[model samples]
Target: MKTIISTKYIKNTVLAAAALFAVSATAQDADDTSSPFSLSGSIDTYFRTALTTSDADGTYAPEGASTSFANQTGFALGMANLIGTYEAGDTGVVVDLVFGPRGTEATFENDVLNGIINQAYAYWNVSDKTTLTVGRFNTFLGYEVIAPAANFNYSVSYLFSNGPFSHLGVKADFELSDDVSLMLGVMNPWDTNDISLTGEYSLGAQLGLYDQFFNFYYDSGRNGGLGFEVDYTGGFDLSDSFFLGINAAYNTNSETETGFYGAALYPQITASEDFAIGLRGEYFAYTADGFDDVPVIGLTLTGSYSKENLIIKPEIRLDSWGNDFEPFTDNDLAPSSSLATFAIAAIYSFD
Candidate 1:
């Protein structure tokens, strides 16, 4: 087989860090050859159709960079993931792998792929209330995760799509109390999984509060000299079967002086043990260097049905904006400033 390995940012950093960590750990670590390990993951597929006739594929306008999960006109494979975790004493390791268009496109930073690794990290429990970790890992900025099985809606929000998906670096997590904790780290530049080859490094931190019925998480980071962002997320359980979640974010770049601010609300109701419904209402706007602020509103409704380890999600979404922007659809067919789409997805998970 033919293969290529690029000297991208993250690859070099990951290799050097992993080697150093291994050497330091091996000297003081005790063997746990008898310890147990486990494997688990999920597979997902979907069909989507845009309601607009502006494009042959009925592709929705304003679906921009983030809604590509179900952009295909017909049946499409979303992703296949496999996760392996092993823990023995104070040391642990995790390896997550994924494949599919959504998987590749989302993390193809620097246009490099090696076994489609989503996260490969190792950690040591410094103490009962503290831990230190290194390698690639998911970001703590958003309420929605990279896994489809974990999200109520199949389509991703603009905040999640546009924000950093993962980080490559070292971090320390501290549990301060029963309801509060803190995470601090230094990492590669924002939105890039590998090192950026630049000497500049980003700083990251997350403060979290988790209680019985309410949870709040806030994340902030500066992308070296380029920009900075703040993301806040909160969740509340109003009743046994009803819940609400909110997310807001603001990001600004130093060079351009442009900024983006957005907010989203997620409300869900459980109709039964096997059926549920949810809605997401969101508003997003951006200010450019020379142009006035432009904004849009999006609404999404989704239903989920579960049977054993299999789950099916059906969703419909609409987006509306002002005439200050170009018509959402291609060829300017949908000049009315709105577009719509519907999609259905099936997911199966196992251990």
Candidate 2:
């Protein structure tokens, strides 16, 4: 929380801007354009608690959490998301905005900009197989998204938490055939909301074959940067009610000799029209020259129920670092290798 950029003054400014955008999305477009403009978004909240006992003063109940978001104990608010789009002919503009704890973490610049804009971009269809996009957009390197309603599991994976969340750049997408596609771009570093003080840049690319994708990112800098990464993310439907999701990534900086590698599997089953269950199992590690590798494994079980626009998810998770590391404290407040926690979240979407 110490790193958060929000303050009382900044918060009020964001709220006012959101209200103005909402009104324009609903009322102003009618007189301005012949193309239909659209608006949509979602809201989420949750309550989480560690199943294990903590230190005497309870200073670190969820410090053992290996990923990001939904880590805070007790009741918490996720975020309020809003998206507005205007399309005409083969070109369009999109404005996505978010507010609250989750939004603050994702953009990392809403407070500085005096608004909650997460992505503001425009796209043009140059041909049947080629298109161009400019400005900020979510990262293309991961399976999970920042939107809570779009993901089956409420919490994200360590790979997702460590990898870039968004990019500020211009990208071109190409469709070579029915099953093959590609993307390439140059950007202002990974997860960067504003161009760096040094005016540095990065490279990004993705190759897609059917449902699978291979993503790559490269930055030349060594300090305070993500030097390089390659990722594979995809999923398959095995049966009418069974599905499998896969994600893996490796990151390393040759100049700095520091890196990490991780992989995760998701298996899910639909039990009924309103109920479904899923599990995520992941193995993650950190590595450096002249140092031993530190590895950890995590497993999560979640059940989801939905009716119309409302979805409810209940989850249980555990993380353990083997003999290589003892990152948690047990019931007796002594060093241990594992921790357990539980949470339930509610999400509502509107269009």
**TM-score of predicted structure 2:** 0.86
**lDDT, each prediction:** 0.69, 0.74
Q: Give candidate 2's error at residue 57 in angstroms.
A: 9.3
TM-score of each: 0.83, 0.86
Candidate 1 C-alpha lDDT tens digits along 1-351: 111111111111222222211212222226644434656778999998777646665445444523446667778888888777777888888777789876776677343564387788898888978888898877766666677777788887777776777788888877788777777888877766866666666777777667211212222334434677787776677777887778888877776677777998888888888888899898888766888777878899999888887889999988777536754563456555776878999999776
* Candidate 2 residue-wise lDDT at 112: 58
Q: Candidate 2 residues 1-351, lDDT tens each?
A: 011111111211112222222323444554664445767788999988778757443223334335767767788899898888777788877788889888888887543565477878788888888888888877777777777777778988888887877777888888888878888888886676666565778898888887678889997543655499999887777877888888899999776688889999888888888888899899998788889877878898999888887889999988877645776677787877777888999999876
Residue 6 lDDT in candidate 1: 12
Clashes of 1: 3
TM-score leader? 2
